[model samples]
Target: MSFFKAIRIDQRAETCDARYVDMAEEELMPGDVDLAVTHSAINYKDGLAVTGKGAVVRRFPMIPGVDLAGRVTRSTHPDFSAGDLVVATGCGVGEAHYGGFAERARLSGDWLVKLPGTLTPARAMTVGTAGLTAMFCLLALERHGLAPTDGPAVVSGASGGVGSFAVALLAAAGWRVAAITGHPAEADYLTSLGAAEILAREAFAQPGKPLQSQRFAAGVDTVGGVTLANILAQTQFDGAVAATGNVGGMDLPASVAPFILRGVALLGVESVRPRIALRRAAWARIATDLDAALIDAMCEVIPFDQALERARAIVTGKIRGRVVIEMP
Candidate 1:
């Protein structure tokens, strides 16, 4: 096809809106590897970029998908070539770049990774940014000496994309996992992802003490702001919490007691633009660590044109798990 379907976000004055449109291959930004993008996924960041929920898309008339998977159809970079399957996430994708919301993608070779043998393009997008960030959180905690035998790990926002993967990955690594979600009604869903216990969102949503009676040995917090503060307050001696997202709020209402009194370490997980070595290691871990069946249960596939609707739903906390997009 000389022209392909894509979601294009156009800016009018200060406002931005996205629509499905036909895009010519020449319109794509200059890059080394041109791909027939078969799949992409909606991240919280994606929701913001597509719906203008936040200032996520710095440029107008952009393609705003943070994660994509497909096969190379053309190339110049030494690492990737024609017919090789690949996945690309972060590295300013869908933000600083044209990104993955199109049937075609011309991306820098440095931004692409050959798709792992075990995962299809669709399945890789199902994992996408959420799964990668989840893996980063796990690695940070492990680096801080967290172990399955230390104590149970608590995952906040546990039903969302990153949290769901956190629960599944930690559980698979033999860690006792306690899931915290606003949708307590989906207890069985969380349990099915290997959570040993389901905790109420209210437990962490409200204001909390600076230092509380400890319960968790470690934490993977997707919700920031107060939720993160509370988790730090409740973490055990020498425990670590890998903080990834800020859906709750960016303001960190925390105290130094957790650090000074208990020696609790708060490790920050920076998924986008992570070192190439770490990205390779993390994806390899995901290929083996994340259960395929669990991913099947956790993802909700939506059409490429539904990007705007799904983006709105995600930011409003109306959707669950990963939102994978089937590229046209």
Candidate 2:
């Protein structure tokens, strides 16, 4: 087993395509830890990078998986040793660095986090970057005084990987959840995850009014721009909204009314390049906070060969929940 397979993305004449290819361990980018990846997860950003739809890949000839779970085969770093289960996410992996699209990944030891025995490599990929982002959103809102007693938390983009996790975790934590989605047909699915109510994305996507009737006490928003603006406009006084994505649009198009009149707070949540302590804490929480059944229900395991097609589907909103790519 000297060589392994990976989905390699290369650019030529302003175009790019991701394809499965055989790769040697020695061909990996410089790093201290060598891992045999068991699973990798596709994210919206990875979709953009793999499909060349957005400027997600600054360098050509990259591996386009942002999150992975595996076992350490070799490590010089003091914190790790042979046969340790681990997971790696964020920190520009699958982007500025060659990442987990490969069955083999040589990564900076600094980026590796040991997975607790309670977590399996496959389950770790189910959480991946999207789950971590969802946890960060929950924590941010919590810090800003979000509690189940305040009101139901709203999750925009409810069918997304992050959104789905948010719904399940919040429910497990005893918070009433309202899932807002463009796909109304997913109401039953979201309800099963503990959403007390479901709102149509059409109504939720409308332009902001500076201030609107109070709705969610706290919210995790994966859809930005107008959707974010509206959430802020309607968030309860002193409530918080953690904004994590710009899928709808980039412009905020909002005002100070919500900030001043309502005293609502909008927290920016970024998982990539997060402080080491926060990252570790979030992963530890995910290991316990996420319901195992929900994780299993939301996760779909696919062969590494399907990475390209899955990546395209992710950014196009065709994917529901998380997509994990099993290494060959």
Among these predictions, the greatest lDDT belongs to 1
Estimate, for each residue in 20-80, the C-alpha lDDT of model 1 and write its tens digit: 8889999998899999999998888887887787888877779989899988999999998
For residues 1-328, write the lDDT of model 2, one tens digit per residue.
4778888899988799788888887788898899998999888889899888988887879987889889899999888999999899998899889888888999888888999778888889998888888888988888887799998899999888789888887887789998999888898999988899999998877785889999889999999989999999989989889999888998998999999998999999998884777878888888888778877888899988787888888877788777888987
Clashes of each: 0, 0
Supply the global lDDT for candidate 1.
0.89
TM-score of structure candidate 2: 0.94
- Candidate 2 — what's its lDDT? 0.87
What stretches of model 2 exceed 4 Å from their correct place? Answer: 315-317
Candidate 1's TM-score reads 0.94
Scored against the true structure, residue 162 in model 2 reaches a CA lDDT of 84
* TM-score for each of the candidates: 0.94, 0.94
